[model samples]
Target chain A: MDPYPPSNELGATLGRIRGLVLTQETAQHAVDLLAQVAQETMPNASGAGVSLIHEAQRTSVGATDALVRTADDLQYDLGEGPCLTAWATRSPVMIEDTTTDQRFSRWSGAAAEAGVRSCFSVPLLRGRDSLGAMKVYSTVPGAFDEADRARLTSLSVAASALLGHVQTSETSTRISSELRESLRSRDLVGIAKGILMQREGLTEAEALAALTARARSTGIPFGQLTADIVNGHGASGRRGAP
Target chain B: MIGFPHAEEQRALINAAVVESGFTVGEVWLHYFSLSGEVDEYEVEAYLTGLMPLPSLECDLLALAVNELIDDLPPRRRAPFSDELIRSHAGSGDAE
Candidate 1:
C-alpha cells in the first residue's frame, strides 16, 4: 500500500475525472468545472489557467488572480512561455525557479515582471493534435513534484474533452457566419440575378446558374460576377441601374 | 475579427470530426491542403459546413448574425427598383 495518502487521493481524483469527461454533455459547462477541479486538486498552486488553441491561433482564458493571469497572458500572447511550449511539446515544463530558468529565452523578463517564482504547464493533447494546456503558478520555487505532474496531465485529458466542444462550436459558428454572409449578399446577388433575369431573360435559378457557370468557365468567381453585374449596370445607365 | 478566425476554427473541427469519423489526420490534412484556395468562399464554406452534419453553437451564431443584419437594415422603402434606390438602400451592415 502506498504510504502517502495524498497520492492515492490524486489517482482516485484522476480516475473520477476521466469518467466525468467521457460522459459530460457539453463543452461550455465543462470549463468552469475544470477550473474548480484545478483549484481543489492542486495543493501548491495558488491559481490555474487554461489556454486553448483553436485553429492555428491561440486563445487562452484563465481563472487565476491578476498576477498569474498576467503571466499566462504573456505566455499566450508571446507564444513563447513555458505553458505554451509544454502544451506544444506534449511534455511537462518545469520552471523550478522562474527567476532563473535559462531555457525561457524570452519569457524570463515578463515572468519576472509578473512576479512568478515558479511555473508548470502541461499539454492537453491525446496524440498529435493539441487541444490546449493546463498551467499552474506559484509564488515559491520548488513548489511542484512528479505526482503533481501526473495528476495535472490527467486533468488535461478532461480539459481536452471540454475544449474539443468549444473548438467544434467555434467552427460551427464560423460556417454559420459564411452561410449568413452568403445569404446577406444573396439580395445583391439576387438583384444581380434579377438584373440578369431582366436583361438576359433568365429566371432566378437560371441567373444563379449563369453566374456560377461563368465563375467556373471564366476562372472568375460568383461574387465577382455579382459585382460585375452591379457595376456594369451602374456604368451602362441601363434600366435598373442600381 | 470574425471571418478568418472562425473559418480556421471550422476547418480544425472538420479535421477533428473526420479523425473521429475514422481517417488519418495526415491524410486529411494533405487532401485539404491540396484543394485550391481559388475556390469560391461560398463553396469552401459549404464543404466545411457539410463535413459536420449536425447543428451546434455555430448555427446559433450564424442565425444571430443574420438576425442582427436583417434587423439593422433600413426599413423597406416604397421607391421603385431604380439604381439610385438600390445603391442608397442596399442594406449594408456589420458582416466581418
Candidate 2:
C-alpha cells in the first residue's frame, strides 16, 4: 500500500520532472505547430511567427515562411519591434501600416523593406508572467481588423497555457549546472565522513556530527572544510578525541 | 509511516530552519538529493511540513542540507566600533 496521499504538490512535482525530460526540440516543435495554427487562423496574413523569449533573448522562433523569419529576425536584431513591445508590455500591439507607423522606426523601416507592411502581435501570457509573443504579418496595410485581433488574442492565451509547462533552454541549462555543483559538494562531504569514520572509529552519525562540529568551531565553510579533509591536509595530526 | 524517536520534533525544527533561512523546498530537495537522500522532492516537502514521516537517516540528511544552506548565508551587518573602523581603514593601504 502506498503511504503517501496524492496531492496537488505531488502533481506539480511530477509535472516539473516531466518538463525536465522534454527537450528544447519538443518546445520548438510545439511552437512551430502553434505558428502554423496562427497562420491558418488568419487567411489574409502573409505569414506568422511564434517566438519564445527568455531574458530579452529569443530562445526559439517558429515562422511560417522566409518572410516571417526575416520579419521576426529584424525585431530581435533591432531590439525594438511590435512583437517585443507586446511581450514587454504584456498586451497586444498593432501596426496598421509599417510604412507610416511612427513607433519602432528602425524595425518598421527594415520590416517594410522586407515586404511586411502591417503586423499584429499579442503577448503569450501565463498568469503574471509573459512567456513570449505570437504575431501575424501582412503585405497590405490594415490587414487585421478588431475581429482578427480578438482571434489572435484568444489563440495566444491557449498557446501560453501549452508553452508554460515547457522548459526553455536557459532554464534547463541552469538546473543541470546547479545539480552538478550540488552533487560535487555532496560527494566531498561523503568522502570526508568516510575519513572521519575510519580514523576516529566512529559510527556514521558520530562522524557527521564531528564534521559539523569542526565546521562550526573553526568557522570554515562545510564544503571547503570537507575538501581539505579529503585532500589529506586537514585534521591529520590531532585525532585522538571523539 | 516508519516510526522514529523524536521524528516529529526533528521535522518541526528542520521546517523552522528552512523557513528562517529563506530556502525553498526545491532548493532543500536539490541539496538533499545530492547527499543521496532517497525521498522525492514532493515527499520531502511532505516530511518537512509534518504531513508524513521520513526514515531517520533521511531525516538527518535533510537536516544536514538545511544546516549547510544556513551556514552559507551572508553574515549579518555588524556595527563597528570607532577604533575598529579607523584601524581597518588605516591598515588597508599597507596590509598587502
Q: What share of the true interface contacts does each candidate keep?
A: 0.00, 0.29
Q: What is the lDDT of candidate 2?
A: 0.82
- TM-scores of the models, in the given order? 0.47, 0.59
- Residue A62 miss distance in model 1 (angstroms): 2.7
lDDT by residue for model 2 (B1-96), tens: 268788888889999999988998987887776665678888998888889998776787788778878877889999999999779988787653
**lDDT tens digits, residues A86-189, model 1?**
76777778888877888876686778767778878887775457776778888888788899878887888877776776554443333333334443455456
Using Cα atoms, each model's DockQ against the true complex is: 0.02, 0.20
Candidates in order, interface RMSD in Å? 15.2, 3.4
Clashing residue pairs, candidate 1? A172-B58, A173-B58, A242-B83
Clashing pairs in 2: none
Candidate 2: stretches off by over 4 Å: A1-19, A168-242, B1-4, B7-28, B31-58, B61-96
lDDT computed for candidate 1:
0.57
Q: Please tell me how candidate 2 rates in CAPRI terms.
A: incorrect
Task: Report lDDT per candidate.
Answer: 0.57, 0.82
Q: Model 1 residue A108 lDDT?
A: 69
